[model samples]
Target: MTRSEATPLTIAYTATSAEPGVNIAALTDALTHHANSALFPGDGEVTLVVQGRAPVTFDLTPMRGDQIEADMHKKAEQINDQLNHMLAEVAAHSEILEASTNGLDVLGVYDQAIAATPQGGEIVMVTSGLSTTDPVDLDAAGDWQLNPSGFVAQINPRDIPDAQGRSITWTGLGQTSTSHAAGTTDPTSTRARPNSQQANKKLHTQHAPGPAARQALHDLWLNLCETSGASSCTIDDSLLPATPTTATNRVPVIEFDQVTTNCLGTFTLAADIAFSPNSADLTQAADKLLAPIADALATCPDGRRINAYGHTAEVPGSGDGIGLSTARATNVLARLQQLGAPRNTIGIPTGYGDTRPTVDNTPNGAYREDLARLNRTVELTITN
Candidate 1:
């Protein structure tokens, strides 16, 4: 089961008040199963770190099974026992510390783990992901709407020390929980069946986030791991499925249209590339948004003509929609050429303005800004 005898493993965890959704028992069981499997190398050293206002670290016994499967099983059992005890200690300490206003710092712990581990070592994070610390405060209101790409763009990779070539795993993200006073059992528990009046009474609760928020939380971590240059990234969301089920609010960066005769390909750029009001200048984020499209266009067969068409929303007060749209298309094509799309293959940029909106500008005599946003887009078409 050993890939290399030198690689180490680090398990970093945080237990906060909002941790009912994370089943520590289940995680322990999963870890125990993995300890006996090929996933954990017999020679790898393991460490456990509990993240709080100040992180605590524990060095666990290494696996010394030699070539005997029976010896490996014995060592695995010892490791499992040690891990369980460490997790219980973390939980007890967190319960006592929950009264403090400062919550657990997940990113800080991650940075520490990444710095400590070698290049091929794995770092497993067990967290509720509701960090209240700097760098990234997942508990903030604005963070709930953060998209993966946008959120990753905000982070400077240099801040994470020794991040390259590491493997990362995250569990129990976006899960929140509530609890009642001591001696009060959970009303929903099967062991207790209180009267109707007792059941109807309200208890202090931390409402779980909706599907969209959960998805955003998951995507944020996934993107962060990718940006950190992890050799592999895995999510062990035992309570919830690892894959997010709900659709996100943001539109896809680019959507390709069906190929037709005389047209090599066509794609629409909508919410992916944002622009300021009545402005054609590309934002700082435009490069990241357009890089993939430019890379794809660069791979196209030679001699194909590339054209860009820009459209505008039909707002009455918006001045010179045609002129603005033309400038926007021209800027996009220029940027594409700069990003390695063939400059010689570029065709004239055109402005359809408010003439070819994908959606209705007004519905039931009311203007819808959301629909108008869809109308304001640029389409890139490649032809024979």
Candidate 2:
């Protein structure tokens, strides 16, 4: 059968329960298994529309609370590890076909889609799902759709059990920039050294992408995916440069002692941002959590440009929480602007969502606030 005839070029994932908690890794894996078992059968164009609650949290700890920050950060690392593992697995397994992402990043989903799609196949569109659906027809002919029954949307992390399904919400889902939000306008500007440990590990990596090198890196991923057939792609977050500078070339790595990387000091979880039963709006308390971020940026040297890096918990079809990731990104950036950050200086908040996690989401029952918290941070690479 021709590629089109083998299966419905488009397949949608509807979560049985809207409030499935923040354990998106589990949900995504379950959905992938279901899709693999049901839709694709063997291998076909995999396009899933995952409609469910937003699984993520954006709570910052109080001041003078290193222990809370340290613990939360550690949890974040663990969650990231899980996400990365899942990405590698997906890259390894699914023959992606022509796929589109609602929250995954260029690096996270592009390679997988490229590997799955044959030459002359359509270019995958990685975007947001505010509600219904975003078009994903490369041929510009197929009309696709994704309808969320009663999914909750949030911008924070923490499972709140209620008459509604248990869910982790990000109080800042459509708020403002947190870390580095890069795109065409605010492309991967530079490969500068980091100002802090996290920044150092991410921004100063030798193999990090530069202007001339980024395209090649992107193309390499695309080519790898095109030929990968059914292989997963995973990259160590440590390898990524922390402070992404804006330049036409690669910048040298900045050491930890050079600048005060403690721009945001610590993230204290005041009250986990809770979403209404099933929408992506931030609660009053959740909105308060992001106000200090603007203050954090204001304390930066020039305070003009700050990186808004997006993350997620998990969602069905498109990894654990990539959809949540992008939504959080958009939310964070919006919040920052609302809190008074200049619009132009603020880069586009990009979401890698649940495609890359720092922990594993397998085995038996693994659902909790801490685990979800691991996937609910927005890194900021303060720029001069």
The Cα local distance difference test for each model comes to 0.57, 0.32
Candidate 1, after superposition: displacement of residue 2 in Å? 8.8
- The backbone clash count of each candidate, in order, is 0, 79
**Cα misplacement distance, residue 336 of candidate 1 (Å):** 30
Per-residue CA lDDT of model 2 for 1-384, tens digit only, reads 443333222222221111111122333433333223221223322333222212111111111233322344554443345445545654453322112223212223333333333443333222211112212111121111100100111111122111111111111011111233222133333533222233433322222212212212222333333333323322111111122222111112212111112342222211124233223455675555456556556556554575555555543344455555566556666777788666654766666665664333321444444334445544444444
lDDT per residue for candidate 1 within 1-384, as digits (tens), equals 446534566666554443442334555554554454443434334555554334345433434553423466676777677677767775676442232233446677788778767787778877766555656664443422324445556767666445787889887776544343211344556543121123323322334543334445566677677877789877654453222111101110111121111225455555224466768988766665466556656776787777889988788666548888899899888988898877766788999898876556666656777557657777666676
Alpha-carbon deviation at 88 in model 1, angstroms = 7.0
- Model 1 lDDT, residue 83, Cα: 73
Q: lDDT of candidate 2?
A: 0.32
| RMSD from true fold, candidate 1 | 17.2
Task: Indicate which candidate wins on TM-score.
Answer: 1
- Cα error of candidate 1 at position 371, Å: 32
